[model samples]
Target: MKKQYIFAVVVICLTLTAFLLTDSSDTIVKYPTGYRNWTHVKTLVLEKGHPLYEAFGGIHHIYANKIALEAYKSNKKFKDGSVIVFDLLEAVNSDNAIAEGSRKVVGVMEKDSKKFKDTGGWGFEGFNGDTKERIVKNMYGECFSCHLSQKNNDYVFSQYRK
Candidate 1:
């Protein structure tokens, strides 16, 4: 009877552990649909001479969904369902003009209070230009660490500019 009880408890614990792990992984953020059609927040150019140019050299266009825009405009902590997209493209120079070139990547930030509580209620992902392949595999180590510095701003780096 004692052996049977111990085996049952172990089995129950293992099942619970498996369920919790699966639930967490299932909460991984999915690619936002029609993000390109969202509101354009701003555009910036990271030239070759800039300090972060090596890692992020390009033309960056920031976009925010309705949910995110509201929070940004209100200057409040973003709530769940808020999403921000960072569209990065190469910078093409022609004569004396510089313009956006081919896309390089699309970095995304999604806010879900419960799903991403460990990362300040934000999930980070970087998809390749095509938006099909995810380039960022580790959110906590690669993305969250940097954004953690901006905890006061709700782990967000960009500010809504007009």
Candidate 2:
């Protein structure tokens, strides 16, 4: 009788474990319909003499990546994540325009551009493109407020501009 009782207890434990793992309430993905367009985008390289030259005067190719995570405003789905790209350029030293150096850093970062303004659109957690886990959730601020310290040149290091 003891053996039978122990067996029954084991069965109950296994069943409970399975039910907990399969629970959908913990990982429910929620988002509004017709909100996928906010996530698709392409990189851009501003050329000289362009209307946006002042903003991207010496900017060259802009490298960026995309990921999906839970949305902050409306959507709470991991189907969307924030995409971040760094703009690399040959910047002129602030003291002298004739001096040149490479500035391979982020000038601007767009998170969930497609779904950025969408209600229920997911927001990004982090973007570390160096590793296979380029995008992950539950990390980094939705917006990088630390860059506010660089407000001298519109939040971008203008020292690199020619």
Candidate 3:
């Protein structure tokens, strides 16, 4: 009887764990629809030999929404609801000219002070290529670790361009 009771408790615990893991709550950051039409903040290209070449080696464009744009231009802390996007593409160097190739990934940063309180009121997500499929398995360790260094800049790396 004791063994059977322990088995039932284990099963209940497993079921609760599965439910929590699969909870479709607001913690999940959605793909930023209509982000292309947002304000374009800046652009950059990282080629071979650069320290960040392996992971971020490519052409990248940064975009900001209204809230983020104002904060970026004014040099103020990004408020809640601010969003920034990092659009990366392959760099094609041909005919002595550099051009944009296929898209590599689309990274997004969303701010929600109350909801995303753990990650400094920001949630990071990466979409594979042009698809909406999520690629980031570990949000804090993978993305937040780098952003954490830019704490003074409200956990953002890109600066305002003239």
TM-score of each: 0.83, 0.28, 0.84
lDDT of 1 by residue, 11-129 (tens): 99999999998885568777877988999999899998999898689999999999999988998989899999989999999999998899898899999988888999999988898
How good is model 2 by TM-score? 0.28
User: What is the lDDT of every predicted structure here?
Assistant: 0.89, 0.39, 0.91
Model 3, runs deviating above 4 Å: 1-25
Estimate candidate 1's RMSD in Å: 4.1
As a whole number from 0 to 100, the lDDT of residue 154 in candidate 1 is 92
Instruction: Report the Cα lDDT for residue 30, model 1.
Output: 73
Error of 2 at 56 (Å): 0.4
lDDT (tens digit, per residue) of candidate 3 on 35-78: 99999989999999999899888999999999999999999999
The regions of model 1 sitting more than 4 angstroms off are 1-25
The residue-level lDDT of candidate 3 at 110 comes to 95
Q: Rank the candidates by lDDT, best first.
A: 3, 1, 2
Clashes, model 2: 11
Greater TM-score among 2 and 3 belongs to 3
Q: Cα RMSD to native, each candidate? A: 4.1, 12.4, 5.6
**Highest lDDT: which candidate?**
3
**Residue 140 local lDDT, model 3:** 90
Worst 10 residues of 1 by lDDT: 24-33
Give the CA lDDT, 0 to 100, for residue 121 in model 1: 95
